[model samples]
Target: MTILSNNSQVTYSGTGRRKKSIARVKLTPGSGKLIINGLPGETYLQFSPNYLRISYSPLHILGLSNEYDIYIKTEGGGLTGQANAIRLGIARALCTINPENRTALKSEGFLTRDGRVKERKKYGLRKARKAPQYSKR
Candidate 1:
């Protein structure tokens, strides 16, 4: 089931994607705790400052960093992709809580989806754009 449809009066939810990663985020009233895949955010994201910053960008941008709890369930892709996906999901969930935030979030580009993905390799290519080696002999 999608996160948006699963939201209740007390919870706001959003779904986000980046590369091969997908994140479902839920926002609820509580201490400013963050959970990812059933683990604490700090533990799941490790000590990477970049991951923490990227994952919490949306909340920080809106000055709501310590207002609510963040719960994320993500799969696919690497750490960076998962972080960005969670950021987008949180931004969307915030918009659900207060539609007025939509303008600010959209203006900040958090509402825009990243469509970039790896291209498939061609039949005769080593990679998406890499050509096979030439043998002049």
Candidate 2:
């Protein structure tokens, strides 16, 4: 939960990193009119069902102002990663919305980036850090 200075109507943007993808979300103080590349809610399902809910439901959470415009730009990774990225971005945007609520958001661990991901295999003719054909003869 980082506290950022309040900037006037500049469309507060936040960056969230998850897995192998990144999400950039822009938020403004206004009626809830979430616009994603000029698409409606149905288009979100095309990418992923999990992500669709994460992106479009953050505002509905308690202590969040419903009046706002949410815009998200995400690239790379799978649907799950995208959804996580969106969550982080939205949490950051909340900071810009009301610096006072930073504590609340932080308590929920929303402002933190989840750095857990699949590990790559090591060069050993087997899985990562694992050896093959161990004979106990």
Candidate 1: which stretches are off by over 4 Å? 1-9
Structure candidate 1, residue pairs in collision: none
TM-scores for every candidate against the unseen true structure: 0.91, 0.75
lDDT by residue for model 2 over 1-137, one digit each (tens)? 33233764557788888999798888776776666545643475475666666765456564454677677777888767877887888888777767876777787778788999878988875876678988999
Identify the candidate with maximal TM-score: 1
| RMSD after Cα superposition, model 1 | 2.9
Worst 10 residues of 1 by lDDT: 1-10
lDDT of 1 by residue, 10-109 (tens): 7778999999999999888777899999999989998789999998888888899888898889999999899999989999999988889999899989
lDDT of 1: 0.89
Q: What value does the lDDT take at residue 34 in candidate 2?
A: 60
- Leading candidate by lDDT: 1
